[model samples]
Target chain A: MENKSIEQLNDICSQVRRDCLRMVHGVQSGHPGAALGLTEYFVALFFKEMTHNNQFQMDGKGEDLFFLSNGHVSALWYAVLARSGYFGVEELGTFRKINTRLQGHPATEEGLPGIRIASGSLGQGLSVALGAAQVKKLNGDDKLVYAVMGDGEQQEGQVWEAAMYAAHYKIDNVIAAIDYNGQQIDGPTEKVMDLKNLKAKWEAFGWEVIDIKKGNDMEAVLAGLAQAKGLTGKGKPVLILLYTEMGYGVDFMVGTHKWHGIAPSDAELANALGQLKETLGDY
Target chain B: MEKTLDLKFTYTEKKDTRSGFGDGLLEAGRQNPNVVGLCADLIGSLKMGAFQKEFPERFFQVGIAEANMIGLAAGMTIGGKIPFTGTFANFSTGRVYDQIRQSVAYSGKNVKICASHAGLTLGEDGATHQILEDVGMMKMLPHMTVINPCDYNQTKAATLALVNHEGPAYLRFGRPSWPIFTPKDQEFVIGKAWKMIEGTDVTIFATGHLVWEAVVAEAMLREEGISAEVINIHTIKPLDEEAILASVAKTGCAVSAEEHQINGGLGDSIAQTLIRNNPAPLEYVGVMDSFGESGTPTQLLEKYGLNAENIVKAAKKAIARKMSY
Candidate 1:
C-alpha cells in the first residue's frame, strides 16, 4: 500500500520496460510495441495508483479492479504485476511459454495476480469494469474500477454501448483510459477506422473527457489519474484519451505496425537491451 | 417408446419461461441479498420487472447492449454476487459471443446467463430471433454449464438453482408457454435426468420445449402398442451421461427431441455420449438443417418437424433399430 515517489515509479517503469522487452524476446513471440509503450501507465497502477494487495485473488474483496482491454499489451501488465509482488519476480521468464500463468493474454483461470477477467479479445473491458464499479457501490466499498482500451478497439459498437451505460447509470466509480497510440495491427488507427473527433464523441456520450501524454511523462499521467480519482461519485464517468507512441521506449520498434506482434531476433534483442538500462536485472 | 420425455397439463394459462425466470429471480433475491439481476433493455421482456421493482438497488438495467450485460455479469461475480443476466437467447449468445468467451466462461465467473426466446417457439419474430444453435454455442464454452428447461415451472426452478451453483451457466428457455407438467416442487438439479413416464422399449432424450412433445408422443406410441419412456435431459453440457446410459441400458434404443437444430445441440451431446458408452440405436427428432420462418409457435413446431408426431415417429424407428441390432 506504499505509494512510490516519482523517482521510484520511474525506476520501476525502467525495470518493467526491460522485463517486457525481454519477455517478448525470450518467447521469440509477443507484442513488444505496445507492451514497452504502456510501461508508465501500468507501473503507475501497480506501484502508485491502485489499492490492491499482491495475494492474486481473482475477486479481490474491497479492492480496486484494473482490466487490460487491449490485452496484447499483456507484457506491460505482467511485468508490473511481477515486480509489484503478485508473483515471484523470476517468473517473468516463463511468459508465453508452455504451462505458465503469464499467458500471452491475461486470463483469470491462471490465477494470476492483478487480473480479474480474460481480455485478449478487444472492446469488452469497459463494460466489465462498469459492472465491478456498480457492484462496489452496491457493497458500499467505495473502491474504483479502471479499464484501458486501444484507440483502434474503440471502433467496436459495444464500446459505445458500454460508454452510454456508464454515463446513464452515473457510474462515476469507473474510469476508462484509451491507449491513443494512433496505430493498430494493420495500420494507423485513423487509416484503419478513423476515430475522427474522438473528444466530441466521448463528450457526446456524457463522459468527462481529458487528453494526456501517457507514453513518457509520469507527472502528467499522475495528474490525469488524480483528476479522474477526484471525479469519482460524481454524476458523469471520466475517459482519459492517453496519447502514446506505439513503441514508446524502444527505439527500433517505434513508428510501425510491424512491431505490433513480432518478436525481436537475437540481434534485435541485443540492440534493444543496449538502449534500455538493466535497472532491475534480467529475469 | 422414448424415455426422456414427460407431460400432463396442456392448456391452463400457459406462462412464458421468462415469467418463471422473473418469479424465481424475485424469490432468489428475497432469499439471498447477494442475488442480483441484470437486463439489457429487455427488463420487461425477460420478465425481470418484479425483481427490478422490488429490489431496485440490486437490479441493474443495462440498456440495449448484450455485450456489456455479459461483461458486467462476469465482473459482478468477482465480489461473490450471484448475477443472473436476462436477454433473448440470440442477444445473449451470438451478439456478445467474444464477451462471454472472455469475461464469463474462460474467466470461470459464477454468472447465470438466463436467456429467453430460445427456439422456433419465439414465433412471428422469424429467423432473426429464433436462435436454434444457442445450445450448441453455449455448450462449446469451456466452463459454461448449459441448460434448457422445458417449461415455465422448470425454467423458474432452474433459475433459482443456478444461484447456488458456483461457476458460469447458460439457462435457456422460450418466449411462449407450453406444457406446465412438472410438479412445482420438483427439485431442479443440473445434469440430472427426470423420468416422466417409465417405459421399457425406447428412451427419448428431450430438452427445452420438446420435452412436452416427447410426452405427447409417448401417449401416441402407446396407442400403437409401443411402450415409450420419457426422460428430461435438462442440462446439455456436462451431460448426464450416467442417466442416459442407465435409460439406454434398459431400453437399448433412443430418440432425441428439441426445439433446436440437429447440429451440436442436445442430440449431438447425447449421440456423442451414446457412441462412447451405450451406443444405442438412435434417431434424432429435432430440426434438421434449416432456419426458422415467420409463423405462430404451433405452425413453426409442425413445419420444422418439432412436434409430438415427429417424436413418435423417431421413437418407433429407434425401437425398430433396436430390434434389428
Candidate 2:
C-alpha cells in the first residue's frame, strides 16, 4: 500500500466518499456532509501521511496517532480505517446501530481498532493530541501526533485553552488540521459565530498556520499534510486550515449547511451514488 | 471489635489534607515512573509544588484552564501515563463537568482528578470557589470513583491507593488545617468502610472533614448514654452498602454527616442504600439547600450546621426516630 500515486489516492477517496454515503443511507441517519468533505483528507491520512498500524494498540507508543475532534464524520473515518485494514471493510455496514462497535460517535470501549478516544463532544481533540504528543516526547518516540478539527468547533472555549497550552509549552510534535467547510448545525459558521480571519486567529494563538486552498483535492490535501509533517519539531505546533465545501463529490449535497447532518432519501442516495463512482466494492 | 474500641484516639498535630495530597503525589511519582501531574494554575493552592519540583519534566502547569487540563489528562492516559489533575473542587468539577464526563469517565481513562479546597471550608474565597455538589456530579458519571478522604493521613493513604486502582477516580480533600487522626502507615482500601467506632444505639456515617465531627459526636453520644457507631465513608460512589446496612441493622437508625449540600452528598447515598435494602430512620447533617458565604472554616462549619454539635443533634434525632418507630 506504499508509494501510491496521486491518482490512486484520488480513486481511494472516491470509494471512501461512496462508503460514507452508503453507510449513512443504510441507517437513514448520520452526518454525510462533513463525511463527504473530509473524504480526501482521510484517504491521504490513512494511506500516506500517518505512520500508524492497522492492528491498533491502545498505548500508541511508537505510532503516529490521529484524533478526530470533529467526530460527526465517523462514517468517513470508519471507511478509511476499514479500507486501510484496521478492520474488515464489511463492518462499515454497522455505522450507527444497536450492538455495534461503530457508534454514532467514535469510541475505543467497543474494541474499535483505530479510535483511541470517544469524540462527538467538540473542541477536546487538540488537547488530547497535545497530551499524547507530550507523552511521545517523554518516551523519546520521535513520531508525530495528528488531530483534525471542525471550523465551527473553534467557538468552544476549550479549543483556545488547548491552543494556548500547545504554544506556551512549545509542543512542536503535533500537527493539527481543520476542515474549514464554513457550515455548522444551525447555519454557516459565519452566521452562527463568525471566526473572521481564521488563519490570523491561529497565528495569534502562537501556532505556525498553513492555509490549504483546496482541502477536497486529493493532491492538495496530500501536499498540505506533507507540508504540515515537515513543519513539526520547530518549537511550535502546526495548524492547517484546509478550505473544503460542506459536502463534496455529490452535486446536490455540496456547498450547503442543510446536508450537514441529514441522511439522503432513496432518490437522493441514488443521485449521490451515481456521482461517487465506487472504485472499491461496497461493504 | 472490642479491642478496636479500646484503642485511644489522639493526634499530635493538625494539618491541611491538601499537603498530604502533595506528599502522597510526590511519593507516587517516586514509586511509579508513569505518574504525571497537571495543575490548572493553582499549584500552591493544591499543594502540588513538591511533585512539580521533584518531577519538573513530568509536571504540566495548564495555567487557569481546567477543561483543557482534564482533556490533556485523559489524553495522557492513552499512552499508559497515570495523570493526576490538581485543581480546586469547584473548577475541577462544576467548571469542567462536561470535559471530565466525555474525556475521562465515559472514555474510561485512568486519570486521578485530585481536588483540594472542597466544600464550605474553602474559607474566605466564598461560594464561587467552594463546590458542595461535586460529590453528586462526579458520582453520577459511570466509571468514576468518588473519594472524599478525611484528615491528612487518610487523604495521603487515599492518594496512594488510587494509583493502584484502575479507571477514573476523583479524590476530594481540603484547604484548612484539620485534626490528623487515622494511622499514618495504615493501608487504605478503595471501597471498604473504615469503622472508626463501634456501638449499637445509632449509626453515624461521615466523610471528609465531617468524619472528625462524627467522631466527636460519637464521644458526645456516649456521654449522653447512647452508643453511636461511627463509620468513615471515604469512598462515596462505591458506598460501603454492606457495612452501612450492617451498622444500620445493629443500630436501627442512621445519621449521615458531610461538609456538603444535604440533597446530593454522603447522606443521600446512605439513605438510598438503607431505603433499598433495610428501611431505617435517618437524619442528615449538612448544608440545607443553600450556598456558602465568606467565613472562617470554624465559623462556616458552625453556621452551616456541619460541626460536631450538629452531628450530635442529628444523631439524637435519628435515635429518637428509631424509638418512635
lDDT tens digits, residues A138-246, model 1?
Answer: 8888888889999889999889989989898898888899988888988988888899999999999999998886556888888888888888777899998888877
Worst 10 residues of 2 chain A by lDDT: A1-10
Poorly placed runs, candidate 2 (over 4 Å): B1-8
DockQ of 1: 0.81
DockQ of every model listed? 0.81, 0.82
What overall lDDT goes with each candidate model?
A: 0.86, 0.91
Clashes of each: 13, 0
Task: Candidate 1: list runs displaced more than 4 Å.
Answer: B1-13
Number of the top-ranking candidate, with TM-score as the measure = 2
Across B1-325, the per-residue lDDT of candidate 1 in tens digits comes to 2233333435455678788889989999998999999998888889999999999999988878888888888888877789999999999999888888888999988989989998899999999999988888899999899988888888889988887899899999888867677778469988788888889999888998888888788877877788888899888988989888988899999999988899988888889998998788889977798899999999999999999898888888888888887
Residue A33, model 2: Cα distance from true site in angstroms: 0.4
Query: All candidates' TM-scores?
Result: 0.97, 0.98
Best by lDDT: 2
